[model samples]
Target: MTFPYDRARLDALVADVDARLATVEETARAASRVRMRSPGLGAADLAAISRFANSPDAPRELKDLARRVDAGELSWRDVASGRAADDEGVQRALRTGVPDLRRAYAAIREGEDPEDVVEAGRPRVVGDDEDGPSRFTEDAW
Candidate 1:
């Protein structure tokens, strides 16, 4: 003889599945929050970097670094955390481009204009010397 359908058992199974699904969702959300709390680049950080990368005054090295990040060849978190400094490209960017990038990022975080921050960080062009182009402070380089 065939067994009859058990409505009560089916309802219990459905409720169990629902509970499991809710638990999984909550775990995923908590994990996401934890990740955000960790030291890393956020959405605003990426946006600020992108803007600096696209700016007319941005150096080629910085643009290359930013492009690597956009293409997933480089991790923004690693870059921000200084873990990517071993790379040659990163080394070059760090000399000038990275400092400006940091300034821009900080400015954005502080609710200031990133463009102005980047511009202000740039080495001012002093009077041109007969020897060559204008001189800049050693720190600027």
Candidate 2:
């Protein structure tokens, strides 16, 4: 049976699936790291099983893939709670991050040395301009 699609519903679904995929990718990466950097987890000592899954990036295929994955235990609840849980979880994370940004900004406002102020004050994911990428970022802020 085909399920209905709504903006909020789809956004939430995509976010949930994104989170699940990220978790799986994390597990895979950790296993790989332990194999390479640690002991016991040899190159071949990875998980017993692995499979491909589709995503919103491949919308037409994602619903089907999600249905199949939901047949399992851990993923089953994620499927059921997909929309609401993802929506609230994302909202909460973003809501919490704002305070961190504000605190950093506040600290920057109190700096004696302008350069040191911006350097130790705030962290940004994407810097302002990439023209001179190596140039000190404090010049931008």
Candidate 3:
């Protein structure tokens, strides 16, 4: 019995997979760096941002911000802190009635800088108010 597979085709497929894997690894590294710089965001938040950034319908400023984050030139914190507010694409998105874009703009306007709240010794909570009593406080009795 003779095998029907072509060696060249298999080699090309392997090369393509290797390239894709490299791209994925790089993207993960970049995402990790972004998360480190912006502690307020969770994995789900990052995934939503990634999806929006990759969308062709996304504003150009948003895409540029994502690129800058990936390139280590800027962090998601920077963008959240109104870094891209004045960019043309952002302005256009705001003017054209994109609800999500408006929400993003609002976030930029209202977002607090993570670096400002994070202290050397204090632990920062990512979500919810930990200042309130714990849920188990009454149950422990």
Top candidate by TM-score? 1
The digit string of per-residue lDDT tens for model 1 on 2-120 reads: 87989999999999999999999999999886632334456675577677776886788888888888898887678776789799888887787555567666665565654566467
- Candidate 1 regions exceeding 4 Å error are 1-41, 97-141
| Root-mean-square deviation (CA) per prediction | 15.8, 26.8, 19.2
Question: What is the clash count for each candidate, in the order shown?
Answer: 0, 0, 0
Top lDDT hit: 1
Best first by lDDT, ranked? 1, 3, 2
Q: Give the TM-score of candidate 2.
A: 0.22
**Which one wins by lDDT: 1 or 3?**
1
Q: Candidate 3's residue-wise lDDT over 1-141, tens digit each?
A: 998999999999999999999999999989886643333455555566667676796667667656766787755555445676676644554455456445544443355442232222133333456555334422234
lDDT of 2 by residue, 1-141 (tens): 987779898899999999999999999988886523222222221121112224333233334434445554234334223343454432443344446435543453443333443356444445566555554434376
Candidate 3: stretches off by over 4 Å: 1-41, 81-99, 103-141
How many pairs of residues collide in model 3? 0
Q: Local distance difference test, per candidate?
A: 0.72, 0.44, 0.58
- Give the local distance difference test score of model 3: 0.58
The TM-scores of all predictions, comma-separated, are 0.42, 0.22, 0.32
